[model samples]
Target: TKMDKHNLTVLNEFILMGITDRPELQAPLFGLFLIVYMISVVGNMGIIILTKMDSKLQTPMYFFLRHLAITDLGYSTVVGPKMLVNFVVDENTISYYFCATQLAFFTVFITSELFILSAMSYDRSVAMCNPLLYTVIMSQRTCWMLVAIPYLYRTIVSLLITIKIFNLCFCGYSVIRHFYCDGLPLVSLLCSNTHEIELIILILAAFDFILSLLIVLVSYLLILAAILRMNSAEGRHKAFSTCGSHLTVVVVFYGTLSFMYLQPKSSHSFDTDKMASIFYTLVIPVLNPLIYSLRNKDVKYALHRTLGALCNIFSQSSVYHVFH
Candidate 1:
């Protein structure tokens, strides 16, 4: 038991070398990320609330969007608070177990978001290509199944990956070069052979990217064909408009992800990786809700109506107070 405890203490914690070590940059970066995190949380929460409360947003598309917001919120919260703390703290250290937990949750949410986007694309395709049977095809039961599968699948995958990574022998070196505990950075710290784990990470990353991207591409192709077949100019425009927000989101998400993880190892720079990670993990979450809400008329309308209703309630309460 004493020997076991000694071994555990040896790998007790990790120093997270955050975005920058410059004293001058710390406060500014903290302020910037703080604002970014706040907006991300509020925006994603607004999307979830709007989808839930607005009958107009009760369709299958909004259902997927609600889950997307949730995953965005999930991963952002997992990383953001710890990161902000690291900026100001004398030591940006995370405990061994805490790092593993962060990696696990980050993996789960990021992977789930990818598949959820794929599901959303499929929803768009069904709505556009098979308008007549859209409701029947994307029924409530079917919608729930699509989202449930990703969450369940990713949870298992993340746990396995986390367990495998943590099981490696981390000795002497404990400073993670990046802001958070990412797979590659952790792998690099292992004094033991990293070949098998490297291969596994590479395979999993490739599989996730290719599979999800393929779904999005095929769905868009189908949607494109359906749009061309429509005789009405207005109909084509409406179809394209409905698809635009989702397309923008997919492009930004996948593009940044591919650039970050799919690069050759020789070309990898921790600084560059940190920037890319910041974009997807923090910036994108804030962008998704804006992209969806501002671009989609239905979402915009629902937001206005919701705001209007709240205003009415507040105004009525004020009048009642004045009378009393």
Candidate 2:
């Protein structure tokens, strides 16, 4: 046990080779990522704020949406800034503890997103299939529990995976071939056999993925059946409108993640994997707010109201200053 601890202590720092090494690409890449990150933060934050200020949005759907926005904000924030800094800087060195921390938080947030999306799907299903009982079934207490379960499950799973990975000796190489600390890159550096750890990660990831996927699948299937049963065309259209944005986000998010993690590890390509990572880590966060706001009329109305109120406040402040 003492000897194992000593091995892990020897590897204190790891150098990260980011998405690109070309000096010419660095400036453009930095600017692009910076802009994307800013937009993502503002947009997701706006969603959360709109939900809070508008009573019309005080429903289970919006409740789940607010958390989804928060999760996207956090997920991107965890990785984007680090990637931007690494893009501009020379040495992208991260301490073992720091790497572990990044992996831990990233794990929690990413897995949380999956579970939250699943919960949102269930919410949509209830609204469609059992419209009369939707509010009672998805009460405030139930909504809180839906939000809580994912974070609790992922945090515990991440802790176990992190502990297991850190125990193995990283003797050969100290360089990770990615912008941030990810499991596969870190595992590649291990001097010991990683079959056990890989198997553990695979199982955990599968459980998270499959469990959430089943929920989404089942929810949408029920939702589709309900829509088919509706006699009026307008009734079916109204039902689909409520879930269109969520379904779009679900497709994009799950599509990328399934491509990334669900396949055999032997199929992985570092460069290709990094590109896929960018979509989820950078592109998706920016897309989420745009997707939700653009598709949902209620969110657009809320945003307009929020912006109009801010303008009025500013106009009042200006008048007061002039009089003073």
Candidate 3:
């Protein structure tokens, strides 16, 4: 009985510590994270607006990009604000309900983004491989459905997972490791048996990452073959150039996500884990718009028009101020 009491006391103390606190580092970390959050916000919002304003970008590629931007916006919002607040608060605390809400929305946006990227790859395959039927196959109806699948599926699955995790009595620890409540990391703090929840995460993550990557790999393989067959050098260059943006976005986005999720949860180092978490959670969203706009000709043209309009608005505002 005395041994049991001693062991329980030690376990409780460890739980309270929960991922070694670095209060001294909080302010510096806050400033760095804030900049990233802002960049992701402006960058994704700008992409969505650019796609809407540019008539020339009315193709399937832009259609998918608009959705990807929407997902990234939602994804960034889910994690960024709470992390900023942690910098100010002494507890760095999160309530059960709030944490659950964050986890749900985070899962929704992330899974949606992956599927959306896969959809974009398929669009590219069609454009590069079956140019004649591109419009017919990637029709308005088809694109909307592709966008809808993840939202619908994730909503149901995330809700169920959230409920399951919450129902498990967490009479254990509350302090989370990372800035936000990532499922696996949070589950590690629970003293109650949580193997079931962990297994679900592993299985679902495998499906989302492995299955999605296989689809993308097959699609891109066919695309590369078709790109190689083009006889004219200019034709081949244009085709490859058109796909460059999506390829860049895919590699970075999936690479970061795989790094974060594909490993055994036990091996995730706190310092490096936080850094890797920041990549998929914060950085990729900001980079996606820049990658697409910088590489794609139509997106570049649209951005110029947007800049002209913004400059006009600023100039007019200045004139009004002077007259007043």
Candidate 4:
């Protein structure tokens, strides 16, 4: 909405009371977001480190799992640190160039993550549905390709879109409500016409969402049928259990995704909108490592061994020092 030839009128300034403006709120919010961000970093990075260190974890499945952890870290790095600093800083303003950079990274990593998750589901499906063929089909070469596809694809697409968005002239309404450079919301502020870009975005989002969803759906459907065919109830139960948590993660990812981008852009709600952002941006990355690691016995053993070894080393050093 243009207010004047020289100015772009903000219809809703969803004023995010930055730390400098609300001195009373700064301490509390800063402490809160900081803790959440740290937990996300630790949980995701723990998976990455554990997967790399444990020889038993060096399978195609864990290979993708490590990439998934990497993506979550990528996701958090884009949103978390910036918001944390903003909570305590005097001025919360990010420059146009920095904002654009943030926007590009956010899009690239998110698209990559979604693609990786979809590939993971397919991997699980193949393993469960056709155990004999899993190794032959999901070979090292194939697994590596699955990882590389998203990184390359999203890098190209996001770069193109970011260039399109930032090239448009701004009409002076520069305050972004929620933290980060949300592509559509940020694009809405342009002085030039943005309908073309939005349609392109809609097409791009639809491509990412539907393609990933289709792969996931197909994978699960096959897995479910295979699980049902298992002769013993216990066998079936174990098979389904392996994928259940991953399925949960996928549902949450797509559900929040549909709310954020699937809905007509015309119907914008600030509070609900922010909530949807939380789904992919903050919550998904944090939940993924926990979900994959929690019930799986192997992951637990690996983590336990890693911690136990560290403790034993400390105890041995103490004994050596006492003798000395």
- The lDDT values for all models are 0.93, 0.90, 0.80, 0.82
Question: Could you tell me every candidate's TM-score relative to the true structure?
Answer: 0.96, 0.95, 0.88, 0.92
lDDT of 3 by residue, 1-324 (tens): 012222332222111122236777878878987898898888889889888888887887898999999999998898888778777776656666678888899988998888999999898999888889989999989998988877899899888888877666553445566778778766766555788988898788788887778878988999999988989999988888888888899999888877776667688777677878778888888899889877777888888988998999999999999999
Q: Write the per-residue lDDT of candidate 2 for residues 1-324, one digit (tens) a residue.
A: 123433554878899999899999999999999999999999999999999899899999999999999999988998998889898789988888989989988888888999999999999999999989988999999999999988898899999888888887886468898988899888878878899999988888888889999999999999999999999999999999888999999999999998887667688888889999999999998998999999999999998888899999999999999999
Task: Report the poorest 10 consecutive residues by lDDT, candidate 2.
Answer: 1-10
Candidate 2's C-alpha runs over 4 A off are 1-9
> How many clashing pairs in candidate 2?
0
- In model 1, where do residues sit more than 4 Å from their true spots? 1-9
Backbone Cα, N, C clashes tallied per candidate: 0, 0, 0, 0
lDDT of 1: 0.93
By TM-score: ranked, best first:
1, 2, 4, 3
lDDT of 4 by residue, 63-154 (tens): 98899889889978988888778876665767667777888999988888888889989999999977999899999999999989889999
| Cα lDDT tens digits for candidate 1, 1-324 | 013322434688999999999999999999999999999999999999999999988999999999999999999999999999998898899999999999999999998999999999999999988889999999999999999988998899899889998997886678899999999999988867789999988888889889999999999999999999999999999999999999999999999998998788799888889999999999999999999988988989999999999999999999999999
Query: Residue 39 deviation, candidate 1, in Å?
Result: 0.7
- Clashing pairs in model 1, backbone N/Cα/C closer than 3 A: none
Query: What TM-score does candidate 4 get on C-alpha atoms?
Result: 0.92
